[model samples]
Target: MATVTLKVEGMSCNHCKEAVEGSLKKLPGVKSAVVDLDAKTATVTYEEGAVSVDQMKKAVEDQGYDVV
Candidate 1:
């Protein structure tokens, strides 16, 4: 598995955290996702060839957050 840590912006509560995590977990290769609201980042573990970091970023963005 490959892990990607993304700097995210505009996450302020548990709802935001859950939204981001849920979005990432829906991806086919994603093994796990953790969003830290205080640190404003997301750490995702996924199958390397099955998913791309760019796709992960898009997932977060699609949930109405910015992936920096």
Candidate 2:
């Protein structure tokens, strides 16, 4: 398993946190997703071969957020 912490922007509330966390957790091989509104970051744990950083960024962008 591998873990990545991405700095994300435009998250202002719990709903935004939930949205991001939910989206990431829905992806295949993602073991966990934790979104921190105060920190503006998303920490994701997944299988190395099952997912990629680019895919994670795309998933967040698809939800209307910016991974910076």
Candidate 3:
């Protein structure tokens, strides 16, 4: 598995964290996700051959947040 850690913007609370995690977890090959509100970042573990950083960015943006 590969880990993608992306900085996320506009997340203000735990609810935001949940939304971000939920979106990322739904993508194919995603194994796990952990959102850190304090750092404004998300670390996602996914199958190396099945996912990419761009897809992870989309996952974050799809839930109404910006990936930095």
Candidate 4:
């Protein structure tokens, strides 16, 4: 497994946190996703070969957030 911390932007509340976390959790290899609204970041743990950072970024983007 591998873990990554992505700097995310434009999250303002608990709903935003849930949105980001929920989106990441939907990915096939994702083991867990936690979003920090105050820090504006998302930390994700997943099976390394099963998912890519780009795919995770896209999932977050698809939910209207920016992954920097």
- Model 4 spans > 4 angstroms off: none
Q: Candidate 1: where is the Cα deviation over 4 Å?
A: none
lDDT of 4 by residue, 22-48 (tens): 999999999999998888999999999
What's the CA RMSD of model 1 in angstroms? Answer: 0.5
Quote each prediction's TM-score.
0.97, 0.97, 0.94, 0.97
Residue pairs clashing, model 4: none
Question: Would you give me the overall lDDT of model 3?
Answer: 0.92
**lDDT of every predicted structure (CA atoms):** 0.95, 0.94, 0.92, 0.95
Candidate 2 segments whose C-alpha is farther than 4 A from its true place: none
